[model samples]
Target chain A: MEKIVVVGLGLIGGSLALDLKKRGDFKVYGIDQNPTHVKKAIELGVIDAEISFSELSEADIVIIAVPVNIIPKLTQKVLDVVSNETLVFDVGSVKNEICKAVENHSKRKNFVAAHPLAGTEFSGPEAAILNLFDDKVNIICEADKTDWRILDKAISIFKKLNMRIKMMNPIEHDRHIAYVSHLSHVSSFMLGKTVLEIEKNEEAIFDMASTGFASTVRLAKSSANTWTPIFLENKDNIINSLNEYIKNLKEFKDLIENNNEEGLKESMNNTNYIKSILNGLK
Target chain B: MEKIVVVGLGLIGGSLALDLKKRGDFKVYGIDQNPTHVKKAIELGVIDAEISFSELSEADIVIIAVPVNIIPKLTQKVLDVVSNETLVFDVGSVKNEICKAVENHSKRKNFVAAHPLAGTEFSGPEAAILNLFDDKVNIICEADKTDWRILDKAISIFKKLNMRIKMMNPIEHDRHIAYVSHLSHVSSFMLGKTVLEIEKNEEAIFDMASTGFASTVRLAKSSANTWTPIFLENKDNIINSLNEYIKNLKEFKDLIENNNEEGLKESMNNTNYIKSILNGLK
Candidate 1:
């Protein structure tokens, strides 16, 4: 807990560095392949300084917050460098691959797979903010594989950030996240693509976008580099979700085509249950 | 200019009443098929008082904010009652049908086909709030059919609500809205339906929902009564958008299946243009 190494200076990593630094309890250092982000994180006071991967051995905690595709390799590299007492974790959207990647590593007991359920549409070091993880859910997968000391340290860090922690298997994490997170991104990107393709008049699109459209398409603004991996890594689950989504769309289309008012109404009524779920999430 | 009658006391109608009343520009009265909304509108002071459709003759302007399916009939009734100088407008999502329904009316010149592009997911009088139309867009379709004085009065009213007005053909309005507005509802509802079907563990779904999922699925909370008719009325355009959306999803799926890194990256990069479009909308 004395020294923390955040290995990605993007949104999640940068935010964690800022929060940890503000606590004045840990010396937070950052490492990123992107030199610009590392420099920016230092300049913005997000971290005490930029450190090398070699410094990983001295860190009490190592957090991998890079893209999902890069996370498996990065996690293994960090586990290689960090001491057995150093708790290592990854804040990846998809976790099963990363979990399996290091499941047999000698330092497996030091690594925890986590997904912090929080983010805005923006990215990069500048996109980071204080208290981003506050009051958010942090999902930890394959927790039983981690040593009790490492697990306790991860829990304490999340609690310090005011996050509620939940545990589940990696496979269940991927399946549920596909439905809840990954599929929503696809829906939003397709909605944006559909509107952009059809609306020739840019002025009209800009002028008439109501709050509903804006909110629904917000995730379409997310970074492609970040998302392309998440979608591909969790391909099977995402594809299954997409198939079900398209089927639901087709059923709704039939309802509209046949003017089955009752069926359409019933479908929407059932979907409106999302209100309660959202209320509960909040 | 003197008296305004708003039919339907739901979100759109109630909000219009609140904005016009706050301007102190008109004596605004409300009518709703639902007695609860009628009571709530008066209770919330969203309207001056409840009035019958028979009172339309005395009003200088009448606004129709009913469901899309009821709009054509309601517009016909309003056109029949209002004077030649009295401006009549409907804020239905689908405009072509309402425009066509009143095409042969004697007072067609008094009716301006409009769709004020603003609303929250919540509905009914209780959901109404002040400044709901402020800085929002109001699409006036088939404006050439409305008499000059009526059109000017309609524009003035929307201006008083702090709205930016745009002119469009009724056909174009319905088509564009199907892609931008209507399709968003379907995508969101289907996403909700798909997720709810796959994840019976509500707590897990709720726990994993990030900001992206929450915003993209927000529209699923909309009323079925409000959206069903909109989807049905603009059936062709919605189907077209859904078809394109499904096609895009399939392509994305294939790219993932083949591990076509280049294809996946390119598609996401292209869709990244949405960031610019969204920025412009904001």
Candidate 2:
């Protein structure tokens, strides 16, 4: 059987371990710096065994699922030790930095710079869920740079996990993700902060925040450990998205101020096209 | 059976009529200026009968479920025609404007200024859902001004709908709701607008906007007919919240620009309190 070593056993890694084990295709070894996560993942049956970096050469595959800031360095380290036959992939949210870091590496063609755009607000091995990557999008950036054989292996693995594969330039992936994913997290967090700052009376806010507020702020519950590096690594694109979002917010505020009912209705109507688009526009 | 007339038979009115009829307490009649809404409500059994505004005198209870912009006037008109025993309430999102509209009226004591914080992103009679008010918050603003007997009737009705009742001054309700509810809608709408503006590739945006973006932008799918009036009716308070929200977004952008990891993590950590708070904060 093929041997797979998963580093950073958080939600993404731990979950990958669980589902991968069920496939009966590989023996998955877990590696996480956090001692608690390693023990918990092993106890939870998320991994077949806990392994160290020194043992990485034993594996045919290495999956790096750490936060974005740590991904580039970790991917480089894994590439340094893993044999030429071993395939390495990083599943961080941001792709640019890690892809750039590994671009000039001797084993660049052996590494598949990929991101599985899938997760929950929860984090760590304890938060690992089953079949998380099932039917989700797995983006492989700069696929042409990866060795054809290695890329084929990566695609087969993602397909076995039931994911749809898309290929794009690393730079384009970072730009689009900043708008779709990172900005939503930031907007949710700040909305939560703005409400928290104002509503000192917690119960009252809770009552008013039942339906709409809850859905709107749901992403605010996401882990700081996971998100900090994403916002930092993708700072440029995030700032650009934020600037556009704020400017639109200000225009909306002005429309409300002037009782521009037509303007408000027009904007909202225009945006309602999202309803159809959200029905999984293909 | 006692008579209850529900004005503007849209989602709230239609749903309320359905649930209220299920209680077998009153004969629920619906009146909507849109003939289509009235026809649909009756077709769906959301209302027992269609009635004219002139027939309101026969009602023992009156619910004004019109859009916020028309709520004050329609509520006043109902007050003009209802019998002395009639208990009138407006279920608009903005309470202050509607509450103030009848503050000095001769029938002021007969009206309860209320806002039931419940709804989905969809709208119209077709969107009316069963038991929507169940386990949701129903705010009775300026309750002291409502006649003792009338307020009891309104509370009993809401209780039958399984709502938890809370009371607050109308002005305070408007201010807080702007931050909790209206601000969320604005944030969602503008977020949608921002992404829609940037992603010229609609299909690509849809693929990336699967989970997190979907939740954050869901409210942008809300009916413009329903929300335009809400943002306009609560303009003052909405503007205040939006201003604070815009400022926070700018500060966050600056943090990202500086790659302030600590600052970014701190903001996200603080906002994570929303997770517990959302679990029905004590």
Candidate 3:
């Protein structure tokens, strides 16, 4: 049986461990700096056992699923210890810094930079669920930089997890993801803040909140610990996206204030194009 | 069987007609300036028949489910033709103007001002679905202005559709809904526009967009015809909310630019309170 060690037993890590375990005859071990998460991941069957960094050499695979801010350093640390045969990958949202950090390392080809475009607003081991990545897109950045053999092994693993593979450079991945994923989280969180700041009557706000509001604000409930790092690591791309978002918002505000019904309707109609594109998504 | 006439055969009106038909032996009729909507409503069985405004006198209950811009005038028109015993209501998103429009009408007591807190992102008669209003909130504004008998009938009907009734004044309804409902639509539309404007690569965006993005921008798929009037009708409150929303977004952007990780996390943590409130929703 193959041995797999999953570091940082949060939603992405714990879920990966559980799904990988069910897919093959692997002894999945978990590790987390938070002791409670380690205990819970073991208790919840998210991992077969809890393992330490010292034991990483015995594993056939090392999965780094920590927050993005710590990922570059942690990837280096994991690569330093893992045997040449072990497949090492980090599943962080932002990929550029991590990819750049290991560019000149002796074990650079041993690491595969990958991000599975999957998650819920909830975090921690308890948030882990079966098939979380099933049929989802898994973007592997700088695939050419990884050794052919290591890349092949990573592809097979992702296949077993039922994910579709897409290859791109780290720079492209960060830019697109800033627009599609990170910006949505920021927009939702700020919307939540605006409503919370103004609506003093909590009961009234909750009662009046329709399905539309709930859906639009759903991402506002995501964990701060998980996202703060993402915002910082991908700050440039995210800042660019945020500037565009704010400019559009201000433009929309002007339309409403000026009673530009035609302009507002045209803007909304143009955006309705998203309906068709998103319909193709899960 | 009581005759229930639903005007504007869009999602809200059409769904109400279908749900009302299923709950009782009501002969539901629909009216729409859009002949396609009227025909579609009849074909979808959302309404039993099509009727003219002249036919409203025959109805025991008349529902004006048109756009907010036209709702006040159409509601007053409906009142002019309805019998003294007939119950009339408008389910537009904005309430203050509609309420004020009929405030001094001879038949003011016959109209119940309402906004059912339920709908899908989709619009038109085909978007109508059974149980759309089930377990949702029905906000009735200015119940005091409605005759006791008419208010009682509206309450009973909402109960039959499996909704909880909350009474509010027109001013309060518009103000609160600006935060919880209208503001959400604006933010989502602007977010969609921003992404569409910047990402130029539609295929790339659709591939990378996770469920979080899907949920946050779902309301962007809502109809321009349905929402244009809503934003215009309640411009003051909507504009106010947008200002606050834009301010928050700018502040969040600045936090990211300055690398203020702690401030960003604290903001997200505070907004997580929405999780509890939304959990109570369907």
- The fnat scores of all predictions, in order, read 0.75, 0.83, 0.86
- For candidate 1, what is the DockQ-based docking class? medium
lDDT of 3 by residue, A1-282 (tens): 999999999989989999999998899999899999999999999999988899998888899999998999998988999899888999999999999999998899899999999999889999999999988899999988889998998999999999999998889999999999999999999988888889988877777777588778888989999999999999999999999988898898898888998999999999999988888764
RMSD (CA, angstroms), candidate 2: 1.7
lDDT of each: 0.87, 0.89, 0.91
Model 1 stretches astray by more than 4 angstroms: A280-282, B280-282
What C-alpha lDDT does candidate 2 achieve relative to the native structure? 0.89
Q: What is the lDDT of residue B96 in candidate 3?
A: 97
- Residue-level lDDT of model 2, residues B171-221, one tens digit each, is 888898999999999999999999999978776677787648988999999
Q: Compose the digit string of candidate 3's lDDT tens values, residues B204-244.
A: 87777874788888899999999999999999999999989
RMSD to true structure for each model, in Å:
1.5, 1.7, 1.0
Q: Best candidate per DockQ, number?
A: 3
Q: What is the full ranking by DockQ, best candidate first?
A: 3, 1, 2
* Stretches of model 3 off by over 4 angstroms after superposition: none
Q: Could you tally the backbone clashes for each prediction?
A: 0, 0, 0
Q: Which tens-of-lDDT digit does each residue in A150-209 have in candidate 2? A: 999999899989998889888999999999989999999999999998888788778988
- Considering the two chains of model 3, state its CAPRI-style docking category: high
